[model samples]
Target: MTRSTITGTAPPEAGATDPGRTTAAVPRTGRLTPWLVLALVVLAGSAVLALTIGPANITAAEVLGSTRYHVLTWLAEHGLGFLDPGENPLSRIRDAIVWEGRAPRLFTAAAVGAGLALSGAVMQAITRNPLADPYLLGVSSGAALGAVAVLLLGFTLALPLAAFIGALAALGATLALAGIGGRLTPSRTILAGIAVAQGASALVSFAIVASAQGDSYREIINWLLGSVAGASWSSVAIAVGALVLIGTVLLASARTLDAFTFGDTAAASLGVHVTRTRWLLLTITALLVGAMVAVSGSIGFIGLVVPHVVRLLLGARHARLLPVAALVGAVFLLWADTGARTFFAPSEVPVGILTAAIGAPVFAWLLLRTRGQS
Candidate 1:
């Protein structure tokens, strides 16, 4: 075949009359749309199931009733109601469990999952490394250190702010270390991040050992292990707000991320401001990771594994990959968190532990597959 036929770019003589031929070279949207729809459906169902699967044993009907009651109540309070305030079918306790307890936790899980997955995908792209994740820059470890300090010092109210500061500090330090020679290469960045992560982790351990006592130690350990157990509406607000804002920015920059796939020079040739874009994206990612860790602790592997799984199914085009990965991550973590809480009954496993248990094997398989391909 001629080059024109192989690449689907027609010769100059044929281009004027056969413009439709170029369409064949594009990735098929039909093949991807169904998967995206399926992911959304699964996420919706998972959210419902997660809301019902806690220790309370609330049925689907009660969950639905509670949600409807709260919506109507809010509407009535805001003078937009078409229903009576007294029409709630769920009892007060069940309503509270569904609305106050499970709902916030599930929402926080979904937001954190989506944010982490998106951040991972972007990091992998920007760094040109398949194994890169949100924590590759030490954001999680730094956030953990800040969170541990807050728990130790009894400044729980400032946990989120402290974590954010810690994450930014770690990022700054990583960048400074990586840019020692006035150039930021992926290898240098990764090495610097590892150093930062180790240092932050040590600080966390020392803080815990020095200050934690009894329940404080347990709480610190639980937070380090990652759980959404104490999630409140306020936690939901923080997570969802960060996910909506930073996640939207990341998703909108999908084309720019795609540019980075071809390396800095090529992306610059394509009119992408490589350094500025990279810095902006990295800072945004740090913010998302910090916010998530602040709310849900350092949940592991959702970021690392979700994007790889999605990429295996959807290919590596960022536009399609980002949204689908976000949905899949949300669904995956919702179930994982649910299993963490209910799998062993009364005693709870950390959600991070469950993710690591599942992710480690999946990661091993992926590594083997990648090696075989190589």
Candidate 2:
């Protein structure tokens, strides 16, 4: 398909005059400012619903109360005790709704959603291909090897750690494959991604088949299907750490990614060191995906769908697209998770299954739209 050339708007120069504040040091009103605000509201509402609307039927009020109490207690314990709230019924309910059950799951879902969406956006830019996603490009499979190995061997404690290593390894293999004949081109890079994904898939299958015994086989399948069930405080900690670390890194590199959206030659001419930037971006994305996949298994489509939605609304500027995409992604996953937890009641479906189900029709529509445009 022939893509529409993004034109008219000049890329915002870093450190330029702030158009919004009417000062030289101020930042301009990004073109998608209003849409971004709307996305934020959607995200907030979705998060609230995810936290409160389980089969257990916790209300939004209960969810908020619990979260607030926990935060205040944490603040007090950390020497910010002045922020503590007094005794209240809401606080008690909040304790039940937020701490024991929904908080960790909600956070994990948000983190995984944001991470996948962010990584997908970066990968699409890196490859100059709209079809790119962390999962589709083999980054998730790389992470999955570590996770799958964990399921196969019944490994505890170091599952996330192993997944991180596996992801880096898979990415390294993809890069090595791409650079086989010297320079890394888009076609070569995508081909390498395909090869790595297939290889990872083979290993995962072998692991599953080898452990086809009574216990591990079902565990393997469940793990592959992806779930946010059984999340705990430790998992939340890992996910939060991953989000803060990788989100910061990627946000810092927003300009570089934006440069990449214009294609490699243009990015290079605009002072982006294409090779180094791509390498670093890939590594960062792999790490983010690994951490998220480790916590949430392999929830799909939020990455692929959210960024495109953001692009449609925000016109493909990475600066605007990045945060907005993250928010929209978090919203999508939050609601999807709520559905997964509740739709079948006692029998929970994997969040990944729910996302794929939703994404299929969206994917079809997008393909049709692209074809018509072409």
Kindly list the per-residue Cα lDDT of model 1 for residues 193-298, writing each as its tens digit: 9999999999998888888999989988888888998888988999999999998899889889989878999999999988788878887888889899888888
Residue 374, model 1, lDDT: 56
| RMSD, every candidate, angstroms | 5.9, 7.1
TM-score, candidate 2, is 0.86
Q: Give the count of colliding residue pairs in each prediction.
A: 0, 2
Clashing pairs in 2: 18-26, 66-94
Worst 10 residues of 2 by lDDT: 1-10
Q: Per-residue CA lDDT of candidate 2, range 1-374, in tens?
A: 11223433655783366565533422233445566677778887777766667555667776666667767888888889987565543545546655667777877887788888888888788878888887654766777788777767677747767777777788889889988876777778788989998999899888877776766676656667777876777788888788789888887777788787678889999999888888777777877887887777777777787788777656676777787788778777877887888899878888889999998788778888779766
Candidate 1 local lDDT, residue 268: 92
